[model samples]
Target: MLIVTGYVQVEPTELAQFCNEFSALATATRRRSGNLSYSAAVDDPQDGRLLVVEQWEDQASLSAHLEAADTVAFVDRWRGRMLGNIEKYDASNKRGLMD
Candidate 1:
């Protein structure tokens, strides 16, 4: 499993628009092959920051998703307007905390 997490900063007034647009992207992404999960949430309303989380079956899936036209457009739409870095983690040696 691969996990991706990050935060993006948006203008306070533009938060609604950002969320609406991201909702469309998230809906489509969830239906894509190898996409385990994808979501975003308002992490800091006062700061106008949003947290993004995603789980993928593998690197290929992630690559394909990133290369998709819609995905490209989404990023481009938020370019310079949002600030953040998305980091990926490999969880091949997964474990249960409750185990």
Candidate 2:
């Protein structure tokens, strides 16, 4: 499994638009094959901080997502308007913490 996490800070004035665009992207991403989950949460509306979390079956799936045209376009569109850090983790040794 692969886990991706990140946070992006946008201009407060642009928050609503950002969320709207992200909602569309997330909706599409969720329907892709090998996608375990994808979401963005507003950590601080005042600061326009959005926390992003994504899970995929593996690196290939994640790579495909990154290379997808919509994903590319979204990133390009927001590149200049957002500041963030994104990181990926490999978790092949699965564990059930709840169990």
Alpha-carbon RMSD to native, per candidate: 1.0, 1.1
For model 2 the local lDDT of residue 75 reads 92
Candidate 1 TM-score, true structure as reference: 0.94
Candidate 2: segments with Cα more than 4 A from true spot: none
**Which candidate ranks first by TM-score, i.e. highest?**
1
Q: Which lDDT values do the candidates have, in the order given?
A: 0.93, 0.94
Clash count (model 2, backbone only)? 0
The residue pairs found clashing in candidate 1 are none
| Each candidate's clash count | 0, 0
Candidate 1 stretches greater than 4 Å from native? none
**lDDT tens digits, residues 40-93, model 2?**
999999999999999999888898999999999999999999999989998878
